[model samples]
Target: MQLTKGVEQAICIIVLLSTQDNHNPLASDTISEHLQVSPSYLKKIMRKLVVQNIIRSVPGNNGGFSLAKSPEQITLLEVVESMEGEISIYPDTGLINKVFRDGVHTSKGEAVLHDVFNGANSLLRDYLAKQTAADLLKRTMEQSEIPVLNWNITNPSNQNKKE
Candidate 1:
């Protein structure tokens, strides 16, 4: 069960927001550059996040984006859902149909396999849903020995001038 690019980008955006100074909002262009993604694509993802209330946009001259709530309140599952709907690792239709149709297994064997796969899927979703963005952030901070650099300006010209 692999996560899509949209889902990965959403998580990265959330982590970036969590590391912000809190006083200043993050510009989408800046996030795009940092993540090495296209501005248009990132903007679309950002719109979904805004709609989900996962992040809020500030308009006009000092316009940018910020998390709608604290990191503790957000979950990775929520971020994923905001971008990709829901986390469906397994297809809804029973695997039994495939196995039985293919003659790979008997009907009875297929039924048992279906039950096992369904249970695993349920457990996976429950575990993922239970984890909050705050939990991930905490783990990251604890594990990292190196300090992260802060970029206050969005434009490279401004970033260069600062240096």
Candidate 2:
């Protein structure tokens, strides 16, 4: 139920990069400054993102970090997995077996619990996957005082809504 701060920062970073001029890279310091995090700390989070290919590092004077793929291509779950790894809700399979003295009834109860937890986890995964980074980008643009031209032009789903 809880998301790591690193995951939050990573998503924020992605949103910032998406709004940048021409999707050009932004250095870590600039990103950190925007997010109000220390450059050094952001650097570590950025490293994981880059390694996972959520974002790419550019090599040049102006290079910093940029999304490896378009916002439409990146998912919140992917970003989270990159930063924090896979999450397990009710990961302990043997807990029910150890705790309950009644055998089959306890086993049935455990099965039900597993089904509920697993179902919830799958739903969560689906929700995150459907929430692309591009979605966040659009939301961010909407909230920003600066106006963006042709913002929804590239997103087909948004385009449909506009028409």
Winning candidate number (TM-score): 2
Candidate 2's displacement at residue 24, Å, is: 3.3
The number of clashing residue pairs in each candidate reads 0, 1
Candidate 1: worst-modelled 10 consecutive residues by lDDT: 154-163
Q: Model 1: residues >4 Å from true position, as ranges?
A: 92-118, 143-150, 153-163
Candidate 1 local lDDT, 1-163, one digit each (tens) = 6777998889988887776655688888888888999999999999999999989998877678888998778877788778777655556466556656756566677667667778886777677788877778768667432222354555533332211
TM-score, per-candidate, Cα-based: 0.73, 0.76
The residue pairs in collision within model 1 are none
Off by over 4 Å in 2: 91-94, 143-163
Question: Across residues 1-163, which tens digit of lDDT does each residue of candidate 2 receive?
Answer: 6778999898888876665543457788777776889999999999998898888899898778877877778998898888878755676658778778779878897888989998888888888889987777667656423222223233422422221
In order, what is each prediction's RMSD in angstroms?
Answer: 5.1, 7.2
